[model samples]
Target: HATHCPKPFYSSMKTQLVSAIHLQEVELDDIEGGNDPADDKKDPTYTVEEAVETIGFGRFHVLLFVIMGSANIVEAMEIMLLAVVSPEIRCEWRLEDWQVALVSTMVFLGFMLCGALSGYVADRYGRWKVVVAGFFWSAYFSFLTSYAPSYGWFIFLRSLVGCGVAGVSQGFVLKTEFIPARHRAYLLPLATIFWMLGSMLIIVLGMTVVPTYGWRWMIRLSVTPSVVLLFLFWFIPESARYNVSAGNTRAAMETLEWIARMNHATMPPGRLVESAQTERGSWRILLSPAFRRTSLLLWYTWFVASFSYYGSVLSSSELLEKNLLCITDADAEHRVKHRHEEGSVCYCIPFAFSDYQTLLISCLGEVALVPLNICLLNVVGRKLSLALLQFLSAIFFLLVNICTTMLGFTVLLFLLRALVSMNFNVVYIYTAEVYPTVARSLGMGFCTSFSRIGGMIAPFIAQVLMSRSVMYAMCPFAVASIVCALGNFLLPIETKGRALLVRLCPR
Candidate 1:
């Protein structure tokens, strides 16, 4: 076979080792008919996708996992902080129920305001810069929120915190850019463990600290990590794919070289492959024919996922307060009768028992769900995993209305919480995988912002409907879940084991 080939193909062995070139059927005919020796000698060019795929998964990916996972941790803590502290703020300020709900609504409204902007800027400028700014932005506002003199100031600062935390959504795109196609589904779901840990940490903190130094101190302490993450952000690199999409070929080459060196992988000797483009994408493109179906479905799914997840979490502290109080009361009664004292209590206030205990168990639900979610995503892929989880959550919600015993009600709530947590993990992974590099950050941001709309509405749902009946309170989420499950089936693409596209724009 070697003797039959042209002399140029056998002239140098080193080029063969360095290149992944292959002869297509069309090229084979040319080779046989008499092709140019000089053309073959010049070396083949590759696209950015081909070069990056060659580097495979290694050290650079692990660093991305750490940084991006840490961002999720921060976001989870910040989100939980509001629910944990809102009660205390209510008691201290004598704020109305509507006022407290407004405080929760404002945070997500702030998310709505800036979520798209974070994605656009990340796409246009770079991921690292937006993420760095997000860390400091959240930390500053979170710390300032701890010092708010009035309810108005508190709501304003928390809104700013929402805007700052919006940067965490960028983690999905930033990390996805580095991950190899084969490992995307498997690794992305594992990031939820950080979110689980963050949820647990806030509960633990609320249990331990809120009773002593107060919610203000807890907020202040939580902001401390922002400084560390901001410093660490300086060491993180930009996405090489983003570089290529933006037509920064030199920067793209440098990034690929750096990745290859760090991963101990080989780089091709000739120019790095890249798919260059002249113009950046706009949000309007999301409405175009290619993306319209998937985009709308993602928006609906995000909305339902956010509504169910946050509604279950935020309301657990309030809706289950009565059940928790009965348990606490029983223990207090036993201790008082036995010890013959004036009901020596476990916590500073009765409200703390209801708030902290429900919040703590709600977080535990997320922690327990992670392992199961990891398995489901790997086995079933995105659509079924999401549909099943949403359906299960709806069943749990309906059961919560029927349960007569306090234990059964709490158990069902936990199930609902866990299922919603799993739904969140799957949706985040799915959204990150579906869009190409050009529109990835914006796609995620737009969907995330729409989810915040659900989040904004959730407070009112819990506040209004739960007062009528548990069944009534849960109806919207149940309906939303069904809608989402149906929408999941309509998703145009199944991104499992698929290569991340460098660009999705028209030729």
Candidate 2:
């Protein structure tokens, strides 16, 4: 090139060489500084689990907690409403003990029937869609229940309401997917507070509204939360983990971006690494060799938790009735005769003011034990903590047999409720953690459906048998709790401090 030897050519050659040298120096500086221009052009990538962990806990999580917790409150209120309104419905409709129990049985029957189906739908469609539909369905039926002219209509409508409640757990799944693993240990357990609040709220309304305007108005008022939830449903985003599993990478990224914005955090610079698509909501995965034992054990634990918890709630009125009879010996004979004639009537009114107060106090147990549960979840882990709670619950149920005074009975009952509530809390957290996102809702639904089987059978013991013999009814609860405790010890996996799986690894 120098051989050209024209002045213009030489000048051009000099400029070209100088520019090349400057560029080389700039690149060398960049290399020494460990900055790569290539990296600047290339985006970072992360899995859903990594993204969730990186996002950490923040304001968005708090808002999600409130919204999802409110959903829990509504579900609890609907479920607790059955216990509060059962006696009234029985007396008003002139129904037998079995018939009264049948109402609760039907509600759970519907819940059991729909749980798995809703999970499938949520997994295949979207969690937000199923949740919004569920709230609307439940709200509609609940309003209809207040207008039911006959017992038949009432049970039918309430059963449909139960169907709606089954879908509500998807919201919990949605919440679980968003929450970081560390926060889940406590936050999930804290959700029980809202459930306790709902239970107490219904009891309060039973005391105030039922005695005055009657059960109809109580039903009307109880639907308010669901209605309010319908309006706020807009705030909840579809789960990003779900999006990735469903092959919607773009949607997943958008959700993460929105979360980062809300939390005032930065998104990881790279795109999401789309997870391998799974057979959405496949029951086979739950029963595969890897998960079979855990699934079976979890199903049973759920059953026992629901059985013992609902049995205690439903039997409270009868227990209080008997305790009151013991205290006020003056009306014992008349009340005994009345109960005998009416076939285990707990209250002439749905619940007395004092009865509601006692129930309310007992509900405080659920709230009081939450801290202990969180501590156990974090320390001993989900498996051991659950086993411990179940064992303690069994002991408490046995102690109820020995209670001679109202104070003793109340204390035992409160402790029993606390243990069972904690058991349920653990079961919920454990189940949510154990399953991969691809099948989380379905797994939850399956376990929940099994739990409802216990729920369906509970009314018979709590409403009918407890009315006759306290020991007879409590024995089953104690036995179930013991069995559940043993099952918890056998659980194959412990989810404490582990990241939730986005999808199961291929065999």
TM-score of each: 0.85, 0.89
Q: Pick the candidate with the highest lDDT.
A: 2
Q: Pick the candidate with the highest TM-score.
A: 2
Worst 10 residues of 2 by lDDT: 325-334
For model 1 the local lDDT of residue 451 reads: 93
Query: How does each model score on lDDT?
Result: 0.77, 0.85
Error of 1 at 153 (Å): 0.7
lDDT of 2: 0.85
Show where candidate 2 strays beyond 4 Å. Answer: 1-43, 321-349
Candidate 2's clash total is 1
